[model samples]
Target: MSIWISWMVAAGVVVILELFTGTFYLLMIAIGLVAGGLVALMGSGHELPYIVAGIVGVAATLALHRSKYGWKKNSDASQDPNVNMDIGQSITVKEWQDNGNGKFSARAMYRGALWDVELVAPAAAAGVFTIVEVQGSRLMVRA
Candidate 1:
């Protein structure tokens, strides 16, 4: 069989496999195979150099995927119009710290709940301010 025909067949099979596995990674490989097939059809050479093509395809896929959806900060706390919005927001401590790790229990109304919180850091005293860093069914506080 000619190099072009082989490449074409390989590309078709890659595409079919990509369909079976919905991962974008396989689809990227298929794209690379298609590129190699096209190169073969152009009579670049009989040996498609699949390794190089695969690398290029994978790289292209990752680059495109990363660009399309990357890290994003959660600004919903500020933008969300809800009652419990103040749960993760910063708050003032009404009580004092009694330990080295700022371990103290204090009462603060947040997200419409009267929470029993112990500060994670002891250095943060009763008068100083802190943030509502975590909230479960209960709340965890930090300085």
Candidate 2:
């Protein structure tokens, strides 16, 4: 078998594996394998192809690691609207059951279900509130 063909096969295998993992790291390595295949196709020395592949793979991985998509934001998922669709959505709090100790909470209907909601701060009761965060089944809201 031709050396270039072997490199292409390896790259194909890596790409297939990448589909299952859903991360781009394997895709970068596959790109490196494709680079090796290109070097071999140019009739470079066997050792030269290996070196090119290694360098390309490492560089691509590092580049990906530096990209925004590669790293997750530090924001809490409960407060992020992107993670919890309920965030930023408004709900009605007909009344507040004062828990005393300077805390106010109530059960409100949301998304066709009853939800435990608490004010972000101890404030006067209001008919409307905006969801700020979700903790398990409980929702934190603000006026």
Highest-scoring model, TM-score: 2
Worst 10 residues of 2 by lDDT: 119-128
Error of 2 at 82 (Å): 4.2
For model 1, residues 48-78, the per-residue Cα lDDT tens digits are 5566577779787777578734333465442
TM-scores, all models, native as reference: 0.50, 0.81
- Against the true structure, what is every candidate's RMSD? 7.0, 2.5
lDDT of 2 by residue, 27-93 (tens): 9999999999999999999899999999999999999989986876699999999899999999999
User: All candidates' lDDT scores?
Assistant: 0.64, 0.93
**Best prediction by lDDT:** 2
